[model samples]
Target: MDEQLKEQLVLEATRMLDKAYVPYSKFPVGAALLTKNGQVYGGCNIENASYGLSNCAERTAVFKAVSDGNTSFDYLVVTGNTDHPISPCGACRQVLAEFCDADMPVLLTNRKGNIKETTVAGLLPGAFQSGDMV
Candidate 1:
């Protein structure tokens, strides 16, 4: 992705933080996914009273893109208020692996201007896929 697009994605993700429903953890997170088709999907972490039912920002963005018939992704930007760039949880990493290519760019960012650039496979090596079940 170009520098401009990357900056836009980060801004979008940061904007999504306002929409997070994080009553329990008080930790809001946001994600912006860029599809190969040039569509961007923004999502925020949502929490329910049943903690197990909460959803991560990364998964939300991927799910929204998938629902819109845009599964092929090029970039993903996630932002949170943290000391360092926020890393996606294990489940979110697996979900990203399910839809994005192994080398897809994932930009982890924080409100402190920290950024960690990595890839889908780098986030979760040996990720379990459909083939793993066979």
Candidate 2:
């Protein structure tokens, strides 16, 4: 993506931080997913009483896009209030690999504007895919 588009996506994710429902960890995260059709989906982390049920921002954005009948994505940006770029958990990586192409771009960012650009395959090396099951 171009610098301007990346900046826009980063801002979108930053804006989603306000919508997060983080009561337990108090760590809010935001994600902006760009579909191939030029649709953008924003998501915020939501915490539940049962920590295990809590949803991460990355997954939330992916689910929203999938629900909207958008499975093909071009880019994803995730932001959080951390020292460095926020890294998605193992579960989130798996979920992303399920819907996104192995080479799909994923941008991790922090509140301080630090960004780490990686790909779905880079985030989860040797990820399990449908081909692996067959």
Candidate 3:
């Protein structure tokens, strides 16, 4: 992905983090996804009293896109307040793989304005897919 596009997506994730509804862990997270057609979607983490019901930022963004008739995405940007780049949760990673290519761009970043870019395959090596089951 282009540097400009990566920066833009990371900005969106950072902004969404400000609106995160995290009460339990108090660790806010946000994600921004760029669709193949160039549209962007963002999501903020939401926590619930029943922790199991808590939703990750990445999945929330993808869910919103799917609900809006989008199935494939080109890039995903994730942001949080940590030293190292934040990787997507297992569930979110699987969801992304289901609708995207293994080489899809995944930009991870922290609040200090540092970014680490990698592909879906890098983070989730040998990630399970439908074809793998059969």
Per-model clash counts, in order, read: 0, 0, 0
3-61: candidate 3 lDDT, tens digit per residue: 89888998999999998998789999999999999999999999999999999999899
Maximum-TM-score candidate: 1
TM-score against truth, every candidate: 0.98, 0.97, 0.94
Model 1, position 23, has a per-residue lDDT of: 93
Please give the ranking of all candidate structures by lDDT, highest first, separated by commas.
1, 2, 3
Better of 1 and 2 by lDDT: 1
Question: Candidate 3, clashing residue pairs?
Answer: none
Q: Is candidate 2 or candidate 3 better by TM-score?
A: 2
Candidate 1 lDDT, 31-60, residue by residue in tens: 999999899999999999999999999999
What local lDDT does model 2 show for residue 48?
Answer: 98
Indicate the residue-level lDDT of 39 in model 2: 93
Best by lDDT: 1
Q: For model 1, where is the 10-residue window of minimal lDDT? A: 62-71
Stretches of candidate 2 above 4 Å error?
A: none
Cα RMSD, each candidate: 0.6, 0.7, 1.1
